[model samples]
Target chain A: MTHLLEAKFKITYPEFSLDVDLNLPAKGVTVVFGPSGSGKSTLLRCLSGLERAPSGFLKLDDQVWQDEGIFIPIHQRKIGSVFQESRLFPHLNIQGNLLYGYQRTPLVERNLHLDEVVQVLGLGSLLKRYPEKLSGGERQRVAIGRALLTSPNLLLMDEPLASLDMQRKAEIIPFIKKIKDEFETPIIYVTHSMNEVLQLVETMVILNSGKVVNWGPVEEVFSDVQLRDAVGDGQLGAVLETTVSEHDDKFGLTRLDFMGQVLSVPKQNIPMGKKLRVHIHSKDVSLATAAPVGATSVLNILKAKVGKIGAIDPNGYSVDIELDAGRPILATITRKSLSNLNLQIGQPIFAHIKAIKMVHEMDT
Target chain B: MDIPSIDSGPIWLSLQLAGVTVGLLLVFATPVAWWLAHTRSRFRVVVEAVVALPLVLPPTVLGFYLLILLGPNGWVGGPVQALTGSVLSFSFTGLVFASMLYSLPFVVQPLHSAFESVGKIPMETAQSLGASRLDAFFTVISPLARRGYLTAIVLGFAHTLGEFGVVLMVGGNIPGKTKVISIEIYDRVEVMEYAQAHILSAGLLLFSFFVLVMVYTVNRRLPVQVT
Candidate 1:
């Protein structure tokens, strides 16, 4: 159950060098997050043997893919990679592209079936189409199916959604969540979007200037203010991992059970008992001194205590608050509101969540 | 009403030369063009210049060099003559060899550009999918470069069909054995046999015009892909 992927490698360009020793978990989605030109994709390329690090050692569980003396070729590694551009062969039909890897992989080693992959990625209708004819999201879904059909030991995705518009990104996120839940294959995903990192990742690796700035569970790394500051724009928010406890079709609301509190939001189509990751923007959370009146429009009310208070910026009057609500939740409020509420570390307060949106969900 | 009869032997021989030259060049130049398109080695410039020499060098200059190379006492010819008791000069095989050299650039340049346009992304994607290097090339890269192949084949065949100086210098006029259509037309006109020359020349004119038209039409239909 504890599959480990170890990478001790160093690669140098004329102006940049990436030297890192990482022991990444080889089961769930491990997101490699960083700014542009920070060696995030390059690290995945090294793992996939696309760019060989001269002095490197990589081992996935017991399979040693590369070392000082032994180096496996890219085709032999059985690692699937989905690049930003899809990279689907323009000449091949969708079926042909999907089968390109399936046919090459030995039958004895195949763990996924063609029909299962086709159904999972919803590629049944588009099987006869060419890559040029498909939309960006459709192309990516096909690419994912193609990679999954290879039965890869590990899948590498480098900014797979970076090219799509918001709607297209929404279209592809569910498939990714399904893959993480339904498949046993490990995924090393590269992304810079904090929203994506929160929505998808279980293990988070923060890379800055070709070095690992932080690496741990997603919740632990996200709650680190220093790391949050490193990833700027202050888009920091709380990602609550919850299970759908009930769905009230009459009131059009879904009740999510998290840390013994049931939070209500708009009704979701997901089946009851399914796990979901919900993102609550810090700005949307307002602190309350006592439980709000019964008729307030604010839907979510949870008891939490202030944990850490961040410094106020020079121009802006806002400050970030870390709450100890079983699972840590982040809230940003103006200094004026903070003083009026007289918030302090370890002080009990009520968090009135104005809105809660389900960012991603997984089948149990 | 007296028109001299035009011999078709030279016409058939010219067709044979063009066909053989195009076929051999397709096999020979593909690897060279692929290397020229993909390699970043220092020797690429030198090799490129050598392949392109036929484009600028006078046809007679190249033919003279080939004539020496295939002559009875020359380096390549002497060894062949010793082994087989025959010389390559004035032979159909010699003409094929001369045409290959004369049209090297015609076959290689287009193929090289085509290979370059195919780029490395698709091939890299194929490799990621577990295709071997050779398998990926045949399946992904070749189809994408189909237009390049068409251009190369047409240009190589047409250039070989129209060759005069190289064929004259290397193969000479040996009647049915080595006299191609161009040399035959020249010989007819030299003896003031304008009627014979006119008949032969007209057929060649029609044939060349038709080939060019077909090339333009086909290229327009499938428009040459740069990427």
Candidate 2:
């Protein structure tokens, strides 16, 4: 049986209101992606039972957490949450903070063990240190470990990386990825950063103005034109699922196979057959009428067909185009180029890929 | 310079009264302080004003009201006299009760500020970690608010130790029953016993100074302010 997390919430304040009805897969990472003030955090709070909506219904795989008459308080609902701030107990040392939830959970119910979590989060050395003594990254790692040790049925992260500087974010993202890989808990991650969304999302929910604008598989949602508009200009991109096929050690490059086509990226340590998700920004992809013959610096050249063309920008400088390269790939090009090339829907064309970022690697 | 021989009875009585009052006030005022820190109820302002009334109101005014209320035929004292058959006024118990009222804000304010500084995030984080409300309070909120508890205890105890007017109004200088250190000093001075009065007054002044110094030292050494 396919377990599902079903939620329906209607919350209103004088200034803003959130009305979302979501039926999400109860596995992997489901990223709630939106801009700030899109009610992302509020939605996560509702799921965790931290914010109670007057009339709401929620159920996780047939276990009802909240309904018209049945309401489980936050503690009763088996969930773990990591906030933007570490929120570690200042008085308790790292070990105490890690064991707090683990200790409270009934012995029979506890599945995640202390030693395993300590090793996973690399918190062995910090056990005796108080929160005030740890660096920001270390503190956030402990916070994640503390939450995970509860063996929650669902994990919620509300912009865990938002407070961190770039270096600190780099330090913590690997641990978050490791947790996702090692644990069986389904995660609902809320983030406004498209970078985080691309790196972590298995399924995506796009929220805007207190409602779900769209929700689907990562690729489909990224391909949605509405997402392009919501994400604004520079962040528009397509997510492609690919597999490592060959390594050119001589050229310091690795080749990936996506939908029967090959693309090369900067050398990766991942072995052959390992699946990876790569993000290609629309601005990085350019169009050509015919395949270039001579040594062009662009490594990826796929023969494709233009699938759809977006409206000209208000500034009237550029337009967003979608191409069918076995998978939907997006490109932003100048309107002058579009008219210059006489581009038409379903017209055969060549898509030059300038850059591809390796977002996430699937477990082998 | 001669050291005057002092009667230690009033000192012991005062110490006992302060101890009992501080202990009882901690138990009773914790919930009040927590409520004041976190409650969004409209009555919060009213409750806050009531708790702080002792801070601004003259102790004799409070004592006169307490005297009327806890006197033999008064509202609280009448019921107590009938049930327990002991008068509340002019008793050690009456002194404790009055001191608790007199020193309430001293205890509640520090605790309230501490609870406020601890804030809702840690509590919510604890609850999300599967700790029950009561469990979170004990493990997270109480520990985080320890400094507040320290300041409250010292302030409450010291304030009760130095109280004069409330005890005089309700307990009426009954030796070994209601007469505390401050009242003993008053009696000594009234009887022209300058040396004994000087001893107790200087002792209280030094004690108050030390308590303030301790609170300030601890606060400075361990800064737990989150924002």
Candidate 3:
């Protein structure tokens, strides 16, 4: 079955107008990524019915939420939105806040029990605490749980982790990943951080200047050189979907299998046989024309074919190389390295994997 | 000099008037205040100015208009009198009606500010959580605007308690019926009853100070405290 979440909106402000037409996957985490003032939040608001665009149409799966003359009110649309700020009800303790949505959702439509949501988000201990009393991470976890308890058909998170400190963000990312894995609901996550995009997105939409520059599976969209540059600021990177093949306890290393190649990294707590999405930044990778023998400091090495070569930096010192090593990965080498090696498309090469950082580990 | 015992009739009447007036203002002005706080409609300015008219218009001037409006042949009074066959002017209901207009802004402004401070963020969150606009207002907005309710209620009740010119113009100084505390004090002073007037005036002064002190203290204590 091909389930689709479709939306078309035309909203005109005094200074800016947002016009978007999208047919997004109805399941999995779809990311809307863009720079500031690109109308990412505005588009999310249009979907949520908070900002009504005069000309709009939205249909999720078999249901039509909005058409020419008919528009479903926000509450009737069965959507749960989490904003940058937790926006939790200050007066209500966590338990009360969580149940706020629970009580509103029709019993027939309610999918997850309150206890299940609490345990999933690890919010049991904080249930008696108020929003003001909880830490930023704790508040966001509760906010996510509160939204989940609503039994929404669609979940919209607009920079849910933006307000948190780095440590707090690390604390909440796994829970967000957990929701994607455990729940059947489709999630539309809006963010500007390339890290978050790589970590969470399955279907990625690149929004620029109120338009979608690209949209598709994260792997393909990110690997395409033209679309990768659309992310801006030269933060282009590649996302690889891999599985944990083994964890060497004694050696303190984890081995991940991607396509047919295995790469080893510092040991992760993730159990063996778990699937993961790892992002390798273009700048982080180094290449060699021929395979290097035995331990230099780099733990992993793989054979690759050069796909595309281009200068993606302002200073023109570094060149971005797209490689095919079972999966497309980006590597940025100095202009000097590119010239010295005489790199060209279709040329055979070796990607000296100096580092392999897990974007996020997911168990399947 | 020995102080004469104050008659409780006017004091009791004033308390009743203030209580009823505050109650009516909360029920009527709450929705109006919420609208004024959130609406982008062009009529918002005109509505706001009209609600605030009582604050700037002299009490006597407001009372004069109410007197005409609530009179048997006047706008409100005519319809109301025809329906119920009772004079709206010079009645307890008349005093309440007069006080409601006089203290309109006192209740509306505080609630307006409180609602504005709450902004649309929480309400939007609530709506997204499957709460209707009405449900969100009561569940999310009302709780957050508790401090506003306190300020509005205290100010409304207090303002009504000390009302004089409007009460006189509309209700007149009908002893034991429409004679509020302020009117009773005036009557005492007019009759050269200095000791009785002194007792009532001083009591009101102390009571008002206490009420204001309580309001300020509570306002300082709770960030969102409503009760």
Instruction: Supply DockQ values for each candidate.
Output: 0.49, 0.66, 0.51
lDDT of 1 by residue, B56-127 (tens): 999889989999999998787889889998888889888888899999999999999988988888878888
After superposing candidate 1 on the true structure, give the runs of residues whose Cα lies further than 4 Å from its correct spot: A1-3, A243-274, A282-323, A331-359, B73-75, B78-85, B223-227
Q: Which pairs, if any, clash in model 1?
A: none
Tens-digit lDDT track for model 1 on A248-358?
A: 989998999999998988888888889888877777788987886678977788899998987775467888788878888878888999889898789998998887744
lDDT by residue (tens digit), candidate 3, B117-218? 999888888888889999999998988898899989988988898989999999999978899999999999999998899889998899889989998998
If ranked by TM-score, best first, what sequence of candidates would result?
2, 3, 1
> Which candidate tops TM-score?
2
Which stretches in model 2 have alpha-carbon errors above 4 Å?
A249-251, A289-297, A311-316, A336-343, A358-360, B1-5, B223-227
For residues B189-220, write the lDDT of model 2, one tens digit per residue.
99999999999999999999998999889877
Best by DockQ: 2
Model 3 residue A18 CA deviation in Å: 2.6
* Candidate 3 per-residue lDDT over residues A295-349, each given as its tens digit: 5777777789999876556777877788998778888788888889998788889
By lDDT, highest first, what's the ranking? 2, 3, 1
- Residue B181 accuracy (lDDT) in model 2: 91
